[model samples]
Target: MKDNPLVIKLGGVLLDSRDSMKIFFDFLSTYFHNYSRNLIIVHGGGKIIDDMMKKIGMNINKINGIRVTNSSNIDIVVGALAGIANKRILSYLKRNKINFIGVSLSDGDSVLVERSKKLDFKNHTGIPKSGNPKLLFDLLSKKILPVVSSIGITKYGELMNVNADLAASALAKTLGADLILLSDVSSVLDKRGNRIDSINREKFNALINDGTIKNGMIVKVQAALDASEVLGKSVQIASWKENNEKLKLLFNGELSVGTFVYK
Candidate 1:
């Protein structure tokens, strides 16, 4: 029932399980039907993309779990991962009576971006570094679900790949929406791998840089930092492992189940 919308990044793997999704969809339908808040669901396609790569005999290389998208990988990623996933999500939303639309980063409008000079992994690895958040806000203001991929196109008509985490952060900042990141882990865990629950931005950053947080998590935590710094919004990292309260607790009131990465 709030004027500000919630920007949710739907993890690609979450769509794999039918039983789990049914529960999630039901919860989402109930939440949105009763709550008047605007929500823009952004998603990733890591799992699906990996599957396609295997089937096609494409070599999958990862520097800290991010796909090294060469020309060949990019083709399958856009078609199988982004395209197929978008349709599947939209279909599920339709069944629950939650209105939504599948939109490519370019579908809505030109998501102008500047790619690295080449596949410069030493620098940006050829992935597009910037985006146009105005496209997301325009759709959000009009009550569109606006599912987005991490792809972008430059003004000179160059298509490029971007990270979903980065894309979601940019949109949240531009629109000033509550940023919610869904993952497989139960929020930001402590050194012993236990759920840390809630903490301020200062603490989170300190832990991350201090090696208390390392590897793949660094990317997600950093994305939250961008949202908080750019838009003054709070970010939450929660897991779906515990069943019902996985996502709802952060929206509606509940108990400590995940970490709230906030400013």
Candidate 2:
């Protein structure tokens, strides 16, 4: 696997956990500085968006874990994701003295999106059709981390909401970077709730068929599988809740703290 650059997808739950976020960013900043690894962060703001919607008296809906976003919802999503969520992450990075740039998938046309074809949810939900990785590449080359919000824009100048895991997959494929999906859960769990250390495509399919993996995990696993297959490498689904020592071991390849989805 190419080692210089890494793409990490951060779940919304991380944003809600102050302590976890503190440790994560502290370790991340130091890791980046010490290792000089190029990093790109794609973040989800679903919980924040949900809270925003609740405050505005707007009902929220999801279809198969992907939000059902209409035109009206797009405004709220953008405000929550691109606006509040993105800025808050930037603030943390700033306080930590991390060199970073906050951007949307639409920035510099980094990702070209089309209305999601797989799900017939609504008018403004999108999936990345293609991406121009120039901006990301340029930033990474200069050692600047790109903190991306999972918000996209179409050719006709319409904003759309994207599933952050899928967005990270698309970006990883485009940049040929290692993909790491960090979430609250330690790793993909089995029916008995034990963490599965490794999963190949066949095992992944089996788990899905047996209903061992459902809900949001379905999307995360799918994204990891897609990146693994397209990039001919493994994608990791790890926990942000792990302490710094565990995280260090994980980065050094000494301890496997997560499920490795192999091609």
Instruction: Return the top candidate by lDDT.
Output: 2
- How high is the CA lDDT of each candidate model? 0.67, 0.83
Residue range 185-232, candidate 1, lDDT tens digits: 667778887777766768877887777888877767776666555556
Clash totals for all models, in order?
A: 0, 0
Clash-forming residue pairs, model 2: none
Task: Write down the TM-score for model 2.
Answer: 0.91
Clashing pairs in 1: none
**Model 2 over residues 130-171: C-alpha lDDT tens digits?**
478898889888888899999998888878898887788778
